[model samples]
Every structure is written in C-alpha cells, then in structure tokens.
Target: MGKRFENKVVVITGAGGVLCNAFAAAFAEEGAKVALLDINEEAVMQNARMLTEKGCTAKGYKADVLDQESLKQTRERVNADLGTCDILINGAGGNNKRATTDNEFHDFDLPEDTKTFFDLDKSGFEFVFNLNFLGTVIPTQVFAADMMGKKGANIINISSMNAFTPLTKIPAYSGAKAAVSNLTQWLAVYFSKTGIRCNAIAPGFLVSNQNRALLFDADGKPTARTEKILRNTPMGRFGEADELLGGLFFLADEQQSSFVNGVILPIDGGFSAYSGV
Candidate 1:
C-alpha cells in the first residue's frame, strides 16, 4: 500500500519530549517531511539529527510555544525549509510540581513543607495554564494562517484525562487541559468554513520520565497513585505512548477522517468510561 502522508509537511511542537519525539519519527516513517519544534535548542537539534541520519526529511527549530514572535519566526523558517505545514500538532504542554498539591485532600494539620491548594504558587499556576492553553492557541494562530486554504490541513491538540474530570492535586493542569478540549471544538467550528479541521486526543495515565517517580518507587514498585489509576482504568494498565499513534493517524489522514471533526477522542484504555462503579 502507498504511504499515507507522502509529501506532506508535519509540524509538531514539544518535539524534544519523549511522546512528541515518537510522533516525529512516526510521521517521518509515513513519508512526511517532519518539522520538530521545541523550546530546548539542544534537544530538538539532537532529535532532528537523529531523524536526518535515518534518511527522513526532518529538521528541528527552537521556538517557545508561549512566545508569538518566536513562533512567527519559526514559521518563516519552516516555510523556507519544509514548505507550509499541512499537519500541525500542538503537543507542547505540561504540569508543574509547584502547582500541584502534595496531598490530594486538604489536611488541617498538614506539614509546613507540604503544598496545598492554598499553597499553590501563582506563578507556577500561570506557567502551567499558559503553557497548555495559550501555548496551543498561539501556535495555531501562527501556523493555521498557512493552512487556511490548503487541502487536508488540520490541527491536533493534546488534551489530558484530567480534562474530562479534574484529577486530584492538579487544579491548574486540569483547568488548562479543559480549556484545550473546549478550544478544540471551537477551533473546529470556526475553521470549518475555512477548510481547516481541528480535533484533539486525550491520553490517559502514561508513565514517562516526567511522572515516573509519582507512578513507581525507585525499587520499581507501584506507588499509591499508580494503584489508584490502575484500579480506575478498565484496561487495568497504563497506556503506551506508541499506542496513541493509531488515533493520531486516523485524525490526521483526511482520506480516513474527513467527516470526523470537533471530537475529543480519548486514547485512555477506557479510563473515561469506568466510573469506579
């Protein structure tokens, strides 16, 4: 069978990170010219080098998702280097340790060092919120300009399981991702007339370097949080980052999902369905 994305230009933000880096590789293997954008210069450059060495047409660019000017400049470079983006993946988002509460529930006699809802840093909250919500907004504003009239142009935003129902101790992240999910629908309707489709993928508990400590102990035993997650997940396991590829590929390929728009497809192994009942 012919490659699905042959000759397409795919741009992914947060391409330096593990999940998005995997996405970059997948797109390249599908015959797309991939553009990896990340705030970390060294990380993105190294990833780009690896892809290029593998004979994939890929390049990395340094661009902060929150900075419009940085994104504009990166867009110019991407157009010159890879052509206007046909698929834009707004994957640059994350939570902050300071913004999260130490305990899921409030304790009147909590330790002084313990962070609570009241103890959450305002700056940290803003950083996390902006990184996820505004980060998605700004990148779409900059790159969607190029996709205005292009055939099969679309955007994929990253939402989280916290979006559907807020997770404990992560108010900022939950709120921010909820905004992302809402924005996905709004963008779809707004761009429906402009020929640019918008949708999102909400992933469940996937253990990565970012949350390894929270999920498992140094001795490789499951943490309390991990147990809770597994119990709630109908699949009784954490999802693999590679497992998200099927949903992504379905949404990005116009021939397959031309009629699918404004949907928040969850790749969470039934986490959203099981209500602990």
Candidate 2:
C-alpha cells in the first residue's frame, strides 16, 4: 500500500528530541520531504543524514523557534529546497529546571531555609513560559505563512497532559501548554476561511532524555512519580513515540481529517481519561 504522506512537504520543530526525531523519520519513510529543525544543529543533521541514507528526502536546519528571523530564514530555505510546506509540526517545547519547584507544596510556617514556593525563581518560570508558548507562536507565524490557501495545509502543535490538568511542581510548563491548546483552537477558527487547519496533540508520559531521571532511578527502576503515572493511566505504561504517528498522519492528510479542526487529541494511553482508584 502507498503511504499517506507521500510527496508531501512536512516541517517538524525540536527534531532532535526522541519524539520529534521519530516523527521526522516516520514522515520521511512515508515519502514526505522532511525538514528537521532544531537548535542542536549536530543532532538534527545526524537524523537528517540517517533519513537520506535510507533514500528519503530529508534536510536539517538549525533554527530557534523563539527567533522569528531565524525561523523566517528557515521557511525561505525550505520553500526553495522542498517546495511550499503543507504540514507543520510544532514540536519545539520542554520544561526548564528553573521553572520547576523542588516540591509541590508551600509551607508558609516553614523557615526560610527550606526550598518552598517562595523560593521559586522568577527567571525559571519565564524561561519555560517563553520556550513553550512563544516558541509555538513564532514558528507558526513564520512557517504557516507558506501554507496560506494551499491545499492540504495543516498545523499540528505539540501540547501536553498538563494543559488539561495542571501537574505538580511545573507550573510554567503546565500553563504554557494550556495556552498552546488555546492557541490551537484560536488559530483553527482564524484560519478556517483560508483552508488551513490547526490542531494539537497532547502527549502523555513518554520516557525521554528530558525526564528520564525523574521517571527512573540509576538502576533503571521506575521512580515514585513513574509508578504514580502508571497507576493513573488506564493503560498502565508510558507511551511509545511511534504511537503518536497515526494521529500525526491523520491531521497532516487533508483527505483523512479534512473537517477536523480545533481538536486537541490526547495520545496519552488513557491517562487523560483515567482517575486513580
């Protein structure tokens, strides 16, 4: 059988991460001309090279989504090299250490020596907010410009489980992803007349470099948080990267999801629906 995205032009941000890297490679294998964008030039290039070696049309570009000029330049290069972008995957987002609290609660009566909510760094909060929120906005502005009025144009934002319900200790990441979900709805309405569809995927727990330590111990045993996550998830395990590709390809192909817009699909193995019993 033929691939769903054959001969399409697809752009993915944060292409160096495990999830987005999987996205990039999968799209390439399906015969899409993949543009892998990431701040880590070497990592993005390596992934692109691997795809090319397997006879896929793939290219890597180092650009920060926070920088509009860099994203604009990347958009230009992608258009010149791979034709206009029909699919955009906004995958460039993560939590920073500063934005996280040492613990979930604040003891007002506790002494100042303890790390509490009062001890949370403002700079850390801002960093996560900007990276997760502005990162999505700027890239959408820059790349979606190439998709205006084009056939099969779609934008897929990478939201998180925190968007639906705030997670502990990571206020900034949670709130920012919430905003991403809101923006997805807003853009879908805004672009409805222009033939562009905007949607998002809210991924649940997945073991990646960003949270490997938090989810597992040095001996590779599941941590308390990981166990809690599994207990709360109806499927009882972390999701695999490839599991998201079906939703991705569905949103990317207009014929498959032509009327779907403003939807935030949760690829969370039932985590979003389950409650701990």
Candidate 3:
C-alpha cells in the first residue's frame, strides 16, 4: 500500500469494537500512526497489539467519550506517543436495550409487558442520547484542540441512516445520530477559517455483534428482520465493515475531499434512498 498518511497521526475513539478496529487497521495500513481510544481497555489493548504485530504504528489508550477529564488524560497519552493528531474519528456510540422498544410499532392499546412509547423509561432514553451525542461532542472538545490552526486537519464523525430516517424501535439512537449530523455542520462552519474540515459517514446496516441478535437466527441463518432490511435496501445485502474504509480514507485524504465539508456521506447500499414503494 502507498503511504498516503505517512507520519500522520490518526485518533479513533471507540476502537474496541469491530467497526473502529477495522478503521484503526486501515489507517495504520496506510502508514499513519493510529491511536486507538476506547473505554474497554482489554479489547483496545488487544487490537493495538495485533496491529503492532502487523508492523503498524499503533497504541491503545483507555478513554470514556462521556468524560472530559478522562479524554484529557487520553489526549496527553496520544500526544506523547503518536504526536499531535491530524485526524479525529468520533466513533464511540451504541444503542441501549433499555432505550430500545420491544416492538416495531406502537398500538393504540398496549400490554404492560410490551415496551411502548408511553412506557419507555426516561433514564434509559437519556443514557442512549448522551452516549451517541455527547460521546462525539466531548471527544471533539478534547481531541480537536490538537488540530486547532493546524493545516489539513479534519474530523470524521460516525452517523447512521437512522439519523436521516427514524427506524422502528430505536427512537433514541435515531435522534442522537441526527444530533451528530447536525453538529457536524455547525462545527464545520464554526471552524471554517482554521483549515479544518468536518464531515460524517452515515453507514447502512452492517452485520456486527451490536445487531447480530436481531439479524441472525439460532442456526446462523438470516432472520425475518434481516429479510426486511434487505428488501428495503436496493443492493439486497448488508455492508461489510471494510466497505466503510474507502469512504473514511477518502474523507481523510485532504486532496480528494479538501473542498468537501459538512456533507453526510451515505454508504448505505441505497437503503436510505429506497422509498419502499
């Protein structure tokens, strides 16, 4: 592979999971010094070790995106180990089961066993909202400081298709991701003069541990929910984690996307565009 990011320092939050782990490897493969940040120390450390074994410049740091002080410590560690960051990927976010509805649609009259909109827990909703929204904001607040006034510095956010269209049963995630997309635009304008660009990637359904329960049956076959998703998606398949790498690498590359800003690039296999007509 070519050294597009030779000597460039990339920081990725939520690097413990499948998506961000792939991101860490991809950036490192392109000759960038990648710092993997995650609240899960064991997983992040394992990923960092794996990348190092592959001869990629990488290190893992424990960081909670929700805590500013924790991020400060992480920033210090990253700066010391990998130099000031050139790219920041805010990827730490997930849905809470407590915040998700049990059923896809609400009925006029519901049973107590069912988690309808009326019975949704306020604390659960708040946790989900804060995890996805504040998760991005806090990390940006801490990590973006390193890129201030630095030429070609960029920020890439992780949004979802649900941000554009509220999917059934995940109202909190949909709303929080929408906030991320909106904040991306606001920050782009706010930092226009700093030569720093901000953009987001709204990914389609990817088969990962997060949603595997809903998508796969006991025998490792596709569930009814998976069929529905594929039917709505024009491409008739789920995207792979590595599929997101190209869009991410393009947005990270200043030449390809220097003029691009505040755009929510969708890599959803046309799932966001299909009208279900």
Count: clashes, candidate 1: 0
Candidate 1: list runs displaced more than 4 Å: none
Give the range where candidate 1 is weakest over 10 consecutive residues by summed lDDT: 107-116
lDDT of 1 by residue, 46-141 (tens): 999999999999999999999999899999999999999999999999999979998998878888898788878999999999999999999999
Per residue, candidate 2 scores C-alpha lDDT tens digits across 1-277 of 7887888999999998888999999999988999999999999999999999999999999989899998888999999999888899999999987777766667657655666656678998888889889999999999888788988999999999999999987888999999999999999999999999999999999999999988999999998888889999998889999899898888888888999999999999998897665
* Residue lDDT tens for model 3, 1-277: 5698988999999999999999999999989999999999999999999999999999999889999998898899889998999999999999988788878877767766987777778998999999899999999999888898887799999999999999888888999999999999998999888888999999999998999988998899998889999999999999999899989989999979999999899999999899998
Using TM-score as the measure, the top candidate is 1
Cα error, residue 219 of model 3, in Å, equals 3.1
Clashing pairs in model 2, backbone N/Cα/C closer than 3 A: none
Q: In model 3, how many backbone clashes occur?
A: 0
Ranking by lDDT: 1, 3, 2
Local error of candidate 2 at 70, Å? 1.3
Q: Please give the CA lDDT of all the candidate structures.
A: 0.95, 0.91, 0.92
TM-score of 2: 0.96
